[model samples]
Target: MSIESPRTAIVGLGITEMGKVFGRSAVDFAVEAITSAVADAGLDLSEVDGLYVNPGIKNDTDMRLQSTLGMRDTRVLATVQGFGSSAGQMVQYASMAIEAGMADVVVCVYADAPLQEGKRAGAAYPGQARAMVGVGSLPFAAGLKAAPERYAVAARRHMHAYGTTSEQLGAVAVAAREWAVMNPHAQMREPMTLEDHQSSRMIADPLRLLDCCLVSNGAVAVVVTSAERAATLRQPPVHVWGWGQAHPGYVNRRGSEFGLVTGAAQSGPAALKMAGVSVDEIDVREIYDCFTYTTLVTLEDYGFCAKGEGGEFVASGAIAPGGSHPTNTGGGELSSYYMWGMTPLSEAIIQARGQAGERQVDRHDLVMVSGNGGVLDFHSTLILSAHPKGR
Candidate 1:
C-alpha cells in the first residue's frame, strides 16, 4: 500500500569537519558521514538498506560507495543530482522508498572537496570564460564565465525592475555573518557588517565578493526511516511532513521570467499545501544561499514578503537572528560551510530537533527547507516539524 504523504523521520545527522582541511577525498568524507549517521541513529551499518548519494562538483562519490561501505545488500542505491536541489530531493526520494516498503533505513549524503592544495578557495571554481557561442556568449564576451557573473545578470535584472540595490544584497551577507558568529560550525565566524559587504571587491557588477557564498571542503549526511521506527532511534525524530520539487526549464529569450522568479514559487506552495500548513506556520526557514541574491528572490517567491520587496524586507532585519523570521541559523553558505543544499537541509534538521543550542529558535514546531539549483533552474522544498502530521 502507498501512503498519500510519507511521514519519514530524520533521526540522525552527520557533518564532518568543514572547510580547508586537506588530504581527504569526497569518498573518504562520505565514509565518515554515513558511518557517523548510522551510529548517530543507534543503528549498525548493516541496518542501512538504502544509500542515496549526491556527489560534489568533483563527482568522485557514487554507487560504488556501497561496496566500500561493505553493504552487501541494499534495496535502494543511486547517485542523485539536481545541482543544489539534490539534498531535499534525496530526502523526498528516500521517504517515498520507506513508505513503499522499498527500504528500511536510508542515508542521504553530500560531500565535496573542492578546495585544492596550494590553491586559494577562489581558484576552486575558476572564472574561466566559456567559449563565446550562441546566447550564452553574451556573458562570455564580458568574461563572466563563473557563477557569480552569470548570476549577476539575474541580480541586475531584479535590481532594475524592482529597484533592488547593492546595499540590499549586502544586508543578506551581513545577516548571514551575524548568524554565523553564533554558530560554532560556521567557517567565517568573525563579525561582519554592511560596510564590510560594500567594501569587498566586486566579483561581478551588482554582486560583490561578500555577496557570494563561501567555497569549502566538507560533507553532511542525514538518516531517514519510517516515523514508526524513529520512536526507537537515539535522537529526536525530525518528521518529514511534506516535500515538493520543480524543475522548470529556462530559456534565453525575451519575456521569459528566468531569474526574476524561481522554482521556489511553485515548489514552496506545493510543499506547504501538502503539509496542510501555511507559510506563516513555518517557524524556521533554511533556504539555500548560493548567493545573497538567491536568498532575496527565494523569500519573495516563497511569499515571505510581497514580490519585489525582498530588498526592503531583508534590510528591515526580518530574517536576522533576533528578527521575526529566523533564517539560516547555522550561518548559511555565506558564512557557514558550503555543502550545497545540505548546508540548509542539515540546519533544518537541527532546528526541528531543537538541538541547535545557542542559535536555536524558541518556536521551531514547524520548519521549511528550500533548495535551488542551477541558477533558479531546479527547486525543491521540504516541510519538517517537531510533531508528526495530523498531530
Candidate 2:
C-alpha cells in the first residue's frame, strides 16, 4: 500500500565486462547479466516474475525479456527510457509493485550496444515538429547550439565567483583515472595526470575531453526482493532506505548555464528527506558524472559544499578513496565505461555490500547514488544501506 513501508532490499547484483563486450548483441549482454544475478541470489529463473528493462535509445523493441533471455513469463514488466534515471524509475516501480503484491522478485536490467554509434537520427527538431507546438530552436539542443556561449560563461562565472580554477576541475579527472587503474573492468585504466587533462581537446567551453565520460557496450542488473526474503539470501541485502524522484519539468531550452546546479537543488533535498538522513550520514556516493561539471554542480546542490564551493570541495581530494565520501569507486562513468550510469549503481551496491575490494571504505553503511537526466531537469536519488531499514 505504501510502497513496502520500511524499504526493499537488493539481494542479487551483476555487472558485465566494463569496456567492450563487443560482438555480443545488447540482448545477449542483458540475458547474461540477468542469469548471473539470478544465480547469485540463489533463485531459479522461474522465480523472477518481475522484470524491468531500460533499453538504450538504439533499442527499438519491447520490454519482452522472455524471448531474448528465455524467461518463462514475467507477471510485471516496465520498459522506459530516462537515460541515467531509468534504473531509478525501475527500482521505484519494483518497490511499489512488491508493496501492492504484484510480484515477489523483481529484476531491473539495463543493457546497451553501440549499435547506433555512427548512425545519428535526423528527425525534425521539436520546434519544427508537426505534432508538438514548441518555440525557439524548433528542437532545442538542450542548450547545445544556441546557448553554446552559456556553458562556458557559466563555468567561467562559477570560477570567478568561487575562485575555482581549471586545475581543480582536472583533479577530478586525475582522481577518477587513479581509481580506474585499480579496476580491472574499467575501460580507461590508463593513468592520467592534471597535465593530461589540461592539454586534452576541448569539446565544449571549460570542459575538456578527459572531463567527459566514455561510451561503450555493457550491461548491469539488480535483483530486488522483500527485505524478509533478502535475509535468507547468500549475501547481505542492500536495503533501499529512501528513494525519490523530482522532475522540475524545466526544459533547458533557454540555454542557461544554471540548469545543472539549479535542477539538482530541486531534487537533492527531497531524496534526503525521504531517507530521514542528512548529507553527513552518507558514507559513500555515486553521483552521475557524465561531465566533470555535473559532479561539481551536484555537490553544491546536494549540500555537500556551499553553493559555489564545489570546486574547492573536489579539489581537496575529499572525494577520493579514504576521503570524506569516496565516490564512484569503480572509476565512474568518467573513468569507466558509460553504461548509462548503471555501472555506478552496481558500484554502489558493491560498496554497500563491502565488496569493492581495494576501493572499499570503512563504516560504509549507507550510499547515495544520484542520476541526472535531461540536462539535470530530471533527478532520481536512491539511498542504499548495508542492512534493511528496520533492524
- Worst ten-residue run, lDDT, model 2? 120-129
Per-prediction TM-score to the true structure, in the order listed? 0.96, 0.88
**Model 2 per-residue lDDT tens digits across residues 1-391:** 3443456788898788755455787787888888888988888888898999988645733477766766676789878677777777788788777767889999999887763334421211111223334575444445444222334555666777678778887877787788778777788888888999999987667877777777667688899988889999888799888787776665446655454455567666777777778989988888888767777778788888888888888889988765776777878888977777576688888889998787777877988888876555567878889976753
The residue-by-residue lDDT of candidate 1 on 313-378, one tens digit each, is 999999998999989889999999899999999999889899889888999999999998877899
Backbone Cα, N, C clashes tallied per candidate: 0, 3
Candidate 1 — which residues are off by over 4 angstroms? 1-3, 127-142
Full-model lDDT for every candidate: 0.90, 0.75
The residue pairs found clashing in candidate 2 are 126-139, 127-138, 127-139
- Candidate 1 clashes: the total is 0
Segments in model 2 whose C-alpha atoms lie over 4 Å from true places: 1-5, 115-157, 160-163, 251-257
